[model samples]
Target: MPLGADHLIHANVVCSDFERSLDFYTRLLGARVIGEVFEFDAGEDFMTILGVTGGARCRAALLTWSDDDTATYLDLLAFADGGGHAARTAKDTGLARLGLRVRDLAAALAWIEEHGVPVVGGPVTLTPMPGRQRHVVTIRDPDGTLLTLMEFPERR
Candidate 1:
């Protein structure tokens, strides 16, 4: 039996510049900035659970889409002092990515370009693994995290 997971809670991404990341996700992806938190003191304990002996002293923003009621989120984190690095290509190992579904590929791409956000690649159509044809555009967030906007052919 499959695990009865309902929806995603959140994905944490470390950013080199969180403010920039926050602006980008809101302006470009239309995510609602829900809240922000700064880690300190025993706050480092959480990191220890992840095996990072030193607790992180970072500021993070919780973002979600406007239509989302479940409150699923993407947490953008900027670790203390040692800012995070830019995201590598999607094909690169150990990299995490989020693909968002859009209603209109062309319009979405146009809106994204108008925002002056960097397009990492695509807006190209492909019959990739899911076996369904999809129109896709890959973009790099201000902190270089890879996000793909996807438009799928409506089912018959």
Candidate 2:
């Protein structure tokens, strides 16, 4: 029998600044904090799971797009000694971006601009099939993680 998959649990984002990322995702992206933020030092099991060496401390919080208990959330993490950043681009070999579906692309763009976040790419339209139109744009969070906001105007 094939292994069945139900749904995604969450996506992990290692942040350069925990507070800044928390504010950006919550205030600008409309995600609400699922619980209080917590901090902990990496234990043996944690280090092994994350594939890291040496001692490390981290702070984390869960953010959800809605109030639904089963909704996918963002696992925002910040390491105390995380060192330098690489600056991810769309062409990066690993995970490059996260896609968010918005109700109105125009309104979302306007709100993001009003909050002083610049659009890094596209307000381009995609017609994947007949009568199916999508508008998408790219923006970066405080930690330079690209988020692709897409709007599907209609269902065909």
Candidate 1: the clashing residue pairs are: 44-55
Candidate 2 residue lDDT tens string, 42-147: 7878888878877689999899987795699999999998867889899999989999999999999999999999899989999888878899999999889999
Backbone clash pairs for candidate 2 read none
lDDT of 1: 0.76
User: Candidates' lDDT values, in order?
Assistant: 0.76, 0.90
Q: What's the TM-score of every candidate structure?
A: 0.80, 0.91
lDDT of 2 at 122: 88
Runs with alpha carbons beyond 4 Å of true place in candidate 2: 1-3
- For every model shown, the clashing-pair count is 1, 0
Task: Locate the minimum summed-lDDT window of 10 residues in model 1.
Answer: 35-44
Off by over 4 Å in 1: 1-7, 35-42, 69-71, 83-87, 129-131
lDDT of 1 by residue, 1-156 (tens): 999998778887777777777777877778877755455442666877766676556777778885664577887777766643554877787746788888888998899889897788887999876678998998877767788898987642
